[model samples]
Target: MNKVLFFAHLRDAVGEESLEVEAGGKTVAELKAELAGKYDLPRLETVMTAINEEFAANDEVIQDGDVIAFIPPVSGG
Candidate 1:
C-alpha cells in the first residue's frame, strides 16, 4: 500500500489529509487516474506529485510504503 497525501484545497476536496491506497507497481499517472475517478476530482491533472519526499514524474512507478503527496497549485501576491 502507498500513503497518499493531499495538500491545500485538495485535502478539503477529498475530505482527508491522507489516504492509504493499494498502488504497488502502478505508475503515478495510474494512481492519479484512480484518485480522480474515485473522488471525482478533475483538478487532479494540474496537481504536482511527489513520491517519498522527492518530486516524481507521471510515469514513475509506485512502491509499497511510498509516500505520495498531491500538491495543488498555489497563488501568492
Candidate 2:
C-alpha cells in the first residue's frame, strides 16, 4: 500500500488528510485520476505532486510504501 496525502482544498475534497491505496506500479497521473473519480475531487491538472517528499512528474511510478502528496495552488493577498 502507498500513503496518499492531501493538502489545502484537496484535503477537504478527500475528507481526510491522508489515506492508503494500492498504488504501486501506477503512474502519478493514473493515481490522481483514480482518486479524483473515487472522491469526486476537483480537477487535479494544476495540482503539484510529490513522492516521498520530493516533487514528482505525472509519469513517475508509485511504489509500495511510498508517500504521495497532492498540494493545490495557494492564493492570498
Best by lDDT: 2
Each prediction's RMSD over C-alphas, in Å, is: 1.4, 1.5
Clashing residue pairs for model 1: none
TM-score of 1: 0.91
Model 1 over residues 1-77: C-alpha lDDT tens digits?
88999987888889998999998999999999999989887577789899998889999999999999997786868
**In candidate 2, where is summed lDDT lowest over 10 consecutive residues?**
68-77
How many angstroms is residue 67 displaced in model 2 relative to the true structure, after the best TM-score fit? 0.3
**Scored by CA lDDT, what does every candidate get?**
0.89, 0.92
Backbone collisions counted per model:
0, 0
- Report the Cα lDDT for candidate 1: 0.89
